[model samples]
Target: MDQVKTSIENGVLTVTVPKVEVKKPDVKPIQITGKPTLSTNFEEVTWAKLKSAICAIFLKQPDSCDLEKLYQAVSDLCIYKMAGNLYQRIEMECEAHISTALQSLVGQSPYLVVFLSLVERCWQDLCDQILMIQGISLYLDRTYVKQTANVRSLWDMGLQLFH
Candidate 1:
């Protein structure tokens, strides 16, 4: 039997209720919104900013830019079906970076050991930069590149730049 008892003593009131399990209502409401579209120039502008971030990564100053925003920009472009063009721009940027990096080793052939060390360092730095870029463009790599035939993954593309 369910029972509730109440008592008052010395101007103080006390109440006691039967022990019962109370279930909470499970009413989860999800907010849904229509798809968002970017401006025609959005891709160009976002790519420009991302290019700067890539530059920062190559410069070994990745802390200069907001990585989260860069990741979002890449994801947004991929979502908007701009992955192909975005990949091309990334390829161009990476190619340019590799060319510029190799140019530093041009005159160091006179010192074989120094040249070799410089090459090793350059390779390692490039690897590190590529890893950072892969992190930012993970969505692009996983979605578009994975689904597209003949398209190399970001890491593979970065390494191919050296070849």
Candidate 2:
């Protein structure tokens, strides 16, 4: 491991932290837990608002949105349209993957296993990608899914879909 260095000048002290690198995950990643650590970026108000919105959206929180504020904050940052495009791209990719799996398999035992594996990959990829951006799983299903009579959590839904 590389060492972090600290230096002192006339009236100032400087500390340097080495950047850590991440390796590609084996096979794929899964949402094994409610939260996984990821690299974090700027915490300015705009980023904070976006992050909060992301958390709320993931959690399916009813009051987590204030569209007017979201518009203002995103427009102020000049990333409103870009963010929308990126979000759509992500959603489209997810939907494409699901549709591909559904169309290619014929629901045989082996094919079912393969499909389950894909679902596993999907769960992992979703967890990892979203965690990379939001840095939290926001586990909307934890409290409600367990207690609700008719609701299925994403994890549950993924399993049922493939099984």
Best by TM-score: 1
Cα misplacement distance, residue 58 of candidate 1 (Å): 1.1
Residue 96 of model 1 has an lDDT of: 94
Candidate 2: residue 93 lDDT (0-100): 41
Tens-digit lDDT string for candidate 2 (63-103):
35475665454444332223433333334444454455555
Candidate 2's C-alpha runs over 4 A off are: 1-43, 79-163
Q: Give the Cα-based TM-score of candidate 2 against the true structure.
A: 0.26
**Per-residue accuracy of model 1 over 48-127 as CA lDDT, tens digit each:** 98999988888877455588999999999998889999999999999999889999889977888988999999999999
RMSD for each model, in Å, please? 5.7, 21.8
The local distance difference test score of model 2 is 0.49
Which pairs of residues clash in candidate 1, taking residues 3 or more apart in a chain or in different chains? none
lDDT of model 2, residue 41: 40
